[model samples]
Target: MLGPETLSTPPQSPLVPVLPAYIPPDVDMDVVLAEVAADGVSAAPADESGLQRVVADAQQQGIDLKVVVIDTNPPIDTPLRDIATVVAQSHPDATVLVLSPSFAGTHSQVFDRVTLEAGEDLAKTGNPVQSAQNFVDQLNTPDFPWTGLTIVLTVGVLLAAVLTRMLQVRAKSADAPKPQADTASADS
Candidate 1:
């Protein structure tokens, strides 16, 4: 447990970077969350406008997505995913995209971790606006439920095998000779 002695009021690094010189740990999540709550987008002054447009459109389409393109990361060896997590705390059901100059972190209540990674795999990088736009498009693209299909196919195969074995057993019993009536015993 952290005591008041450990609590310090040091200011968090600013979310907007005058220059990309600042890296992870410099991210102020409060500002990010506040901006996202207010505008659905938190980025440079110029980039936020376009990004907000895309995010708003997505929201109107019933897509709960919040984008935070800060020039920052975690307090310890910042990872971009952590940034997304901080935002996710506020909007647990929303998909979040946290973009840095060189890294992208993401979290989604609707998407699995692999799906989030897959989205980042094809999403634009470096340019925040473009990246956010690409992410919107990615969200709109439906992922084929390969896992579900595979499960159904596997179940079908197992059922077929069981049915085949049962039929084989029934046929074998039918083909076997039946004992003749014991007429001698009955006469005796």
Candidate 2:
């Protein structure tokens, strides 16, 4: 019978640079961080139960887990990719995942490249906190990011066109002169 100590382990290799870095092969998670941390690693809020559990699990397995909680409001100039790059620089051999929360919803990255959003079950539940928590719970799962952004953008464009047409019609109607009553005919 296999036990924890008797479990088979994979051979370790020197970390190498990978391209199109979406979801690199499995390695023990060593660091977690937000995009803005000057150093890829830092203390984050204990409220994130999923992250906390990951840290604890790593410790139990004797793997060094570094946690970096990203800033709630990241700078407009700093994108997710940039943050991941920064984290990678700090820990070249380390695997980086970004867990971001927002009022709209929550999402995470795997392999530091592939974007995976939380399932819709939480969002439809109408609880922001719970929805965000649901997002955290599904962070490590093999899911794809929602493509609703494209649809949303398309809707926005269509709406703008409709509004512009309505304004043009209104302007033409307002500019036209009102028909005057024939006072002379009435007097005759």
Candidate 3:
């Protein structure tokens, strides 16, 4: 998870552009275009100013600002990957930032679940960035993925302890000397 300062810092290396090789059939260009427009991006291939607007909007929405604008459409199955690969191949060390409406769904889900578990109202966070950071922190917690294996191991340890205690108690009682009753002399 990136802090606000890290997000604001410009990338040290130049970002390499990667476009999707194929556009998925299900991708609705009109919907995509409308979303772009809403982001204040007037052109498919956003110019410098348009990119800045995108970065600003994303920062406001609590998204990473290292963006890789995909000018052309890509296959639905690997839309984000196709673009990422291109940039990755050219700039192996650079981070790939994909901006798409599709991402909004999953991001919201992550934020919601994290906030729910924290017992905090999402609105109280006051910004998308904070919400996103909280979600990331939740994910990074040491016991984040509490797996079935962990549960089983814990139960096994507890059962062993109880059984050991019970055996110790039984052995101690069995080893004790039997109690003897004293008999009084019979009356003449």
lDDT of each: 0.77, 0.44, 0.43
Over the stretch 42-122, how does candidate 3's per-residue lDDT look in tens digits? Answer: 223525464555446555655433333343434242554443333334435332333333231112222334433442222
- Which candidate comes out best when scored by lDDT? 1
How far residue 64's Cα lies from its native spot in candidate 3, in Å, is 10
Of 1 and 3, the candidate ahead on TM-score is 1
lDDT of 2 by residue, 68-141 (tens): 44445333313434444556565554443343343222122323323322332332233333443353344446
Q: Residue 71 in candidate 2 has what lDDT?
A: 43
- Per-candidate TM vs. native? 0.62, 0.30, 0.33
The parts of candidate 1 lying over 4 Å away from their true place are: 1-23, 72-78, 147-188
lDDT of 2: 0.44
Tell me the spans in candidate 2 whose CA falls farther than 4 Å from its real position.
1-41, 45-50, 58-66, 75-78, 99-112, 115-188
How close is each model in CA RMSD to the real structure?
9.2, 19.4, 17.2
Q: Which clashing pairs does model 2 show?
A: 23-111, 30-66, 32-68, 33-68, 34-70
| Model 1 TM-score, all chains together | 0.62
How should the candidates be ordered by TM-score, best one leading?
A: 1, 3, 2
Please provide, for model 1 over 34-144, each residue's C-alpha lDDT reduced to its tens digit, 9 standing for 90 to 100: 998997888889898888888888888888888888664344323566767778888899998888776677888887777777768656477888887777777778889
Determine the backbone clash count of candidate 1. Answer: 1
